[model samples]
Target: MTSFLPTDEEREFIEVAKGFALEKIRPIAREVEDNRIVNDKMVKELEELGFLSREMPEEWEGLELPLISQAQILQALSYGDLAVIQGLPGAGDAASFIRLQKDHPILSLHKEELIQSNKTIALLDLLEVANSQITIEKTENGWMIDGVSQPIRLASFADYVIVAAKDNEGVPVVLWVDIYQDQVKVDSGDYRLGLLASGTGKIIFDQVQISKQLALAEAEDAVKLMADTRNRIRVLQAAKQVGLMEAALDYATEYTAGRKAFGQEIAKFQGVSFRIADMAMETRIAAHLVWEAALAVDGGKNTAAGSSIRALYRAHRSLRFVTDSAVQLLGGHGYVQEYPVEKWMRDAQAQVTLYGRERELLIERGEQILSGAIGVTV
Candidate 1:
């Protein structure tokens, strides 16, 4: 069974993050909601507090905390404000890549501080893919990147993008290029049902320069990188869902326990109490699935629960069901912005779509499982 419970020090770290979330993030969530842009000051504060790079190692100017601990803290932070920083695992994922890919040039070039912040930020920004055709052709200088990248997270905020574009040889190559010229635009079209912190911006790059050091080595690594990163973030996302469901449960419990309806506390009603019971049950399932995914990945037990299959799949599905129940239990209050459950529900919806489409992911997994050429552990 998967478990993400923290040890003594880890618990302390989570408590600190919780305090920051409650004191700072929660208060300004609504303000960001109204303004439709994350406050730069908050981003600076989060960076200054080392909240953005908590899981990176001391070698990279981070705490190198346990993955489980980082998940817990991120869960709390999302509860405070889902709109500001919904993507939480990039710090940890960057640290893992740097630690694993010893000879990688990307890690070799940056200073320690920039290694923690800039590199991680770059990886985080790559979440935007709007069917952009990437062309990476060898040039006299190095490589020229010509393609239209689709709506990306933090598109307006990022100076460069870590892109997986096709090469002249028809190889799906990866490159990092500046986002200058070529009509960079954001589609602030309609407020998403949730996850307001993300700026859905469509990126266009016309004849941008790419250095060899920044491009990923192989055509296949792009797919692997995306799958690897999703598994990492899935655990953290599940943890945040825990916080969201917990908050919603607390809200429902309080309202039902005191608010009288039909001459009785709503909590006294069997229907209300039963829904709470279901929430509790599903929350446990989600927690177990998330922890299973994290430990399985870290321990190299990928066949059992990693590779974005077993545990991540369970966690994502559980997140959807649990948040839906929470929203329903709260009735109309759950739908309005006045209550935080509505925000949590909206954020959960975005989580479903963030890394990749759930439909495509399932199809890919099915095709892999059905292909009998390679040995796979069930």
Candidate 2:
């Protein structure tokens, strides 16, 4: 089957991204896994390549590329290193939120900062917010936030943190707090099985005070904003997963063709060859599912449903099948840390789970479908 190919511009960007990954990111993947930190050199190179700002509006110091273009870029970068490339430099998601809420007063204060800052910004992920235990209180000076947020992606590298908390009335409140404040504490050295270089950490906010102007969204608006942003992130994540699956399939195919078993190449066996074929077929399906969702988001169609289907497809089935099968084909070599297929498996699992627990997402998607709430977004 002829899968959709990238446009000329997108192909150019992919090549540039691939070169950057091989030259800059791939060399340090092991070092990052060992050290559990993303170095400044990689961050600088990503910035120089204009990756973090690829989707931001021109007025906000972004390239304002189409969402599909951003997805392609992410896939290319993830082909190099998913962890460091996923959300580095800053909270591009926060920028997207700000873009969605341009009329909000909080955006006025942070517009330039969101665009021009060299420091990364961390947005509290909705999936993991329950662990954060955040609450907001109205004070004479402004709003006070208190909570402990665990395993926030890139919070250690972030100069600013964007949080979505609830007020006494249970209304959602979005707050942008400076990480250097006296009340903020970050335990940045935590380790993980995958995405070790994400700089994930535990953050404690003790009576952090910010002006009322920092409250970015509330009530139903905040809920909707979160849903929208989740869908947006899912699209990019699906694209990255496609890259991971494809890379794994490619590596395994090459390995099986060359490696010998019973005095013959393993690829000669029907069982092994069939599995490779299945991996290719599944990877193609995953890629197309991602594109379907991305095109929906780009066209402002039924994004919620489209994104949900994309997430369900990749998280529940496709990636797991591809990565696990790749491992099976590689046998002992796949399990070794020296070969990257094992790392890819771990990374793929971690990413798919980031949106939510698979069981819960499965139920939610089913409910959405049964309710007929899902439209023909694609």
Candidate 3:
């Protein structure tokens, strides 16, 4: 019995975001990607528009919007260009951790730098329990972290990093590391696939010693904090993917409608028309799931975590399908740099990889249902 309609305030915010995205962000996407960084002017504009501080706390000079509102705003912005949106500065994924634990002492130590200096932070969440090259070992004072991490968004420019992982003994811990102070190495490797402007790179920790003072949470506290933060992150990421899907669907539909083939518009063909219909349907479904997940998280429902996993999985699948369809519909034009569909497709693939693996998310959701952790809903 929940309404999916936006409130008047939300509607106004979304419209502004949509307009700014299309007018400002879309035009410079190619330039940003080529330069591997968002220009200073665009970054300043985003900050002025409040898009950079949506998840941050008001005490920290942020809008601190709810996940539901943040999701919609992000969706509108991402519709212009997913790569540009992802490249934006400010807390990045670590904002979820800060939002969930605004009062943590460890976080307070860095609040001044983060808010005043506009320092960026990256989240290296190794709690996935998957195969990771990074290792965390317990030390007398705190822990010793070593090895290289998978490519993380915002890594290249991160002033600080929030590490969520387990020790060699499988004890959960969340640590806040000052990258420059700790002398951590950020490897900005050759990245050409997509999201080239996102500052994506690997963080190399060479037996770096972390003091106990930097531990944000440990043991059971860390586990709960990570789980809640992950739910928010998943829903937000899924919302962005839905925006990309919508962009692909709309672009393809418009192109097909105007382009002539065999003395008629290509939209006249059933094959083209049916594919566009499927793209539209898929985009709608992804948006609905993302909205549902955002609501569940905001409501503090037990199903929030499970719903987030499902939402992201579906968004990833639909994003890939929709982007590819856009490319196919445009025929040769789609593959060329002259059109945006090719870049969208590459960005979509990279987005999914950076967020989560499709099969893994599906399996996680299935496990949650079977264990009665979350109920099966229609």
Number of the top TM-score candidate: 3
Q: Against the hidden true structure, what lDDT does model 1 obtain?
A: 0.61
RMSD in Å for model 3: 1.1
Q: lDDT tens digits, residues 120-235, model 3?
A: 89999998758999999999999999999999999998988999999999999999888985558999999889999999999999899999988999999999999999999999
Model 3 stretches astray by more than 4 angstroms = 181-183
Model 3 clash pairs are none
What are the lDDT figures for the candidates, one per model?
0.61, 0.73, 0.91
Candidates sorted by TM-score, best first: 3, 2, 1
- Model 2 vs. true fold: TM: 0.88
Off by over 4 Å in 1: 1-3, 87-103, 112-144, 165-170, 181-191, 211-213, 219-227, 304-307, 372-378
TM-score of each: 0.82, 0.88, 0.98
lDDT of 2 by residue, 303-327 (tens): 5555746554664377788889988
Clashes (candidate 3): 0
Give lDDT tens digits, candidate 1, residues 46-104.
87777877656566666765556766777677657666665332433344444444355
TM-score of 1: 0.82
Candidate 2 local Cα displacement, residue 169, angstroms: 1.0
Ranking by lDDT: 3, 2, 1
